[model samples]
Target: MPAPPPHSPTSEEDIRWMRRALHLAEQGQGAVEPNPMVGCVIVRDGQPIAEGFHQRFGGPHAERDAVANVPAGVSLAGTTWYVTLEPCCHTGKTPPCTEAVLAARPARVVVAMRDPFPKVDGGGLQQIRAAGIDVQVGVCQEQAEDLNAPYLKRVRSGRPWVIAKWAMTLDGRIATATGNSQWISGEASRAEVHRLRGRCDAVIVGGGTAEADNPTLNARPPGPRTPTRIVVSASGRLAVDSNLVQTIDQGPVQLFASADAAGLQPLVDAGVEVIQFDSDSPSDRLAMVLDHCGAANMTNVLVEGGGDLLGGLFDLDAIDEYHVFIAPRIVGGAAAVSPLGGQGRNKISDSPVFATPQVSRCGDDVYVTARRVSESPPKSVSFNP
Candidate 1:
C-alpha cells in the first residue's frame, strides 16, 4: 500500500530466500507448538528488506510481523514475499494473513509449502491468486514440511507426533545390573534433550521411569514454553516426594493410571490430574494416553519411557520418531537393562523400520535421529511451481 523494493526473479534465488525463511522459522521452535513455525522474508531489489517469524502462539503471524518490519515510509507494492508456509485466508486469533498481504500489494508471493491446516488448506494461495498476484509454491516444500511435521500430523490425524528418546552405552545397556543409571550421555546430549522437551507439548514416561529417575523434566535455562509431564502406570504408584510431584508449581503433571489403582490422594492433592484407563496392557494404555493428548490439542509428545513402557509403545507401533544417544562407554552385563523392554517382536520382519538415521555428535556422545517409515502425512496439495 506504500512504497516498494525489487529482486531477481530466478527460481534459484527464490529457493535461497525460502531457505532463509525456513531458518527464521526455527526461532519459534519452543514457543509455537500447536501452531506451525512460519517465517517470512520480504525482498526488494535482490536484497532482504524485512523478515519475521511466528514468535509465539496467539500472536501476530509471520507475514504480519514481516510487513511490520518494513520501514514506515517504504512501500511493499512490488516486493517479492517469501514465506515458509502459505498465509491464512480466514481470521481466527488474528486477522487473516492474506488480508495483510493483499493490502501490502506484493507483486509476487513465493511459498515453500501450502499450509495443511484444514481451515486454510490451500485457500490462502487461492485468495492471493484470485487477486491477480503471481504465486509460486513448492519451493523448499520438503524442508517446510519437515519443520512443521508435528503440527501437520496433529492437525491432519488428530494425534500428536510421538518422539522417543533414550541414552544407552555401546553395550546397549541403559542401566547397570543394579538399575543405577545416570549421566549415560555427555552434558551436551542431555542439554539437547532439554531443548527437545521445550518444543514438545508433553513428556510421557512409565511409572518406573518416574520413580527411578525422579526427573524434574523441565527445560534448563527455561524455554518459552513448559511441557506437561505425564506418567503412565498400571498401579498408580508415584512417590509423593518425587521430583515431578515436588515441582508441581513449576509445570503441570498428569498421571494415566488404571481405573482401580489407589493411593493417589497425595499426588492429586499436589495438583496432579489423574486420568484413569480401563486396561493395564501397555499398548491399550498408550492408546488411551494418546487419545487424551489429542483431545487436549497436543501436537508434539516427547516420550522418556523406561524399557518396558518403550516396549509397549513399540508393540503398539505408536512411536513416530526416535532419538538415541549412544555413549562411548560400555556397561557390560547380561543383567543390565537395555533400551527397549517388554514383549518384543517375535520376528525381525515384524519390527518397526525407520527411515535412514541422521547421525550427529554431541560432546562425547553420538546422537541419531530417525522417523518411522510407516508414518507420513497424507498427500499434500499439488503445486506446479
Candidate 2:
C-alpha cells in the first residue's frame, strides 16, 4: 500500500491540541488590542512539552515564549508545533517569530489560521516551508478567526468592532414613562455586563444617559485594565455634577460633540478631553467617534446606551454585535422609552437583519447575543492551509 499523504485529514488528537492552543490565546483577550491573540504549544513523541500565549501588546510573540520554555535538555529536532496564528516573519516590537521557530528546528508546524496583517500574511508560512519543515494550516480555523475578530476588523475596516449592549423589559422598554430605569436586570446579568465592559477598550453612552443616570460606567471587580469612558452629545450639555465628570481623576473620559455645543468650557476646565466633530447629524457624529477611536488604536468599543445613541448607531448600520438582556417584568406606558427609538423603518422589509442570536439565561433575565448579518467576514490572507 502507498504511504499516507503528507498533509492528511486532521486527527482527533490534533483538533484537541489546537483547541487547547486557542483557549490559551484567549488569555490575552483584553490586553492585545491591534495585535491578535496567539498561543503556541510544542509536542514531542506524542506528549506535550511547552506552552505559551501572547500576554500583552509589545511583548514577545507566543512562539518565542513556547520555545524558550522547552525543558532545558529537550531537543526540538523532532518536535511539532501548534500555533493559533501563523508565526510572524516581520519584526515590530520583538524579533520575528518565524526566525525563532526556525532556530528551534521543529520537525512540523500546524497553524490554525494565516495572519491577515500585510507584514506577515503568508510570508511566515513560506519561510517555514523553505526551511524543510512540514506545514499544515486551517486546523480549528473558525475558532481562530472568531478569536481575532476585533484585530482583523480593525486592520481591514480602520474602525473598532462595535458592540451595543442594553437591558430592557419584556415589553422592550429601557425605562418607565418618567425615565426611571434603576435596575432592569438581576445581579448576575448586571455583573455580566460589567465583565463585558472590562474587556472592551472604551464604553460609550449618550449625554442624556450621563445626566439622567449619573453612572460611573467603570467595570466592577476590575480586570487587568479599565476602559475609557465616552459621552456623546450634539450640544455637549452634560451635568457638571454627574458621576462621569466627577470621576475624571480615576480614569480618562472623553466628550464628543459639535464645535459650537454649549457648556463645554466647564467640562474642559474639569479636565475632561473634549473632541469637536464637524457635523451634528447622528450618522456623521458616530463616524467621527469611530475615526477618533481608530486613531487612538482602540480595537473594541462597547456602546452602553440610553436609546438615542443606540438608535443612531442602528440607523447608520454601525453596530457589529448586539447584547440585549431581556427581563421578565413588564411596565406598559405610552411615554415609556424603548431600547431603540428613532425614525424607525416604514416597512417590515426594510428592517436590519441580524445573525441567529445565541440566547442563554442569566438569573431572571435572558441574554441574547448576535452579530449584524451585513458584516463582511474578516479579510483573510489566501494560503493553501
Prediction RMSDs, each to the true structure: 3.7, 3.6
In candidate 1, clashing pairs total 6
**C-alpha displacement of 193 in model 1, angstroms?**
1.9
Residue ranges of candidate 2 with Cα displaced over 4 Å: 1-9, 346-356, 374-385
lDDT tens digits by residue: candidate 2, 1-385: 2232366457776787888999999999888776889999899877899999999888888998887788898888868899999999998999999988888888889999988789999999988888878889988887798888788778877899999999999999999999999899989999999899888889999989988888998888886557889999888867778888898886789999888888788889998899998885778888999989988888899998879898888788778899999999899999998988666678998887876899999998999999766446544533333
Clashing pairs in 2: none
Q: How many times do residue backbones clash in model 2? A: 0
Instruction: Estimate the lDDT of model 2.
Output: 0.86
Question: Ten consecutive residues with minimal summed lDDT in candidate 2?
Answer: 376-385
Q: State, as a TM-score between 0 and 1, how close model 1 is to the true structure.
A: 0.92
- Residue 51 of model 2 has an lDDT of 93
Model 1: residue 255 alpha-carbon error in angstroms: 0.6
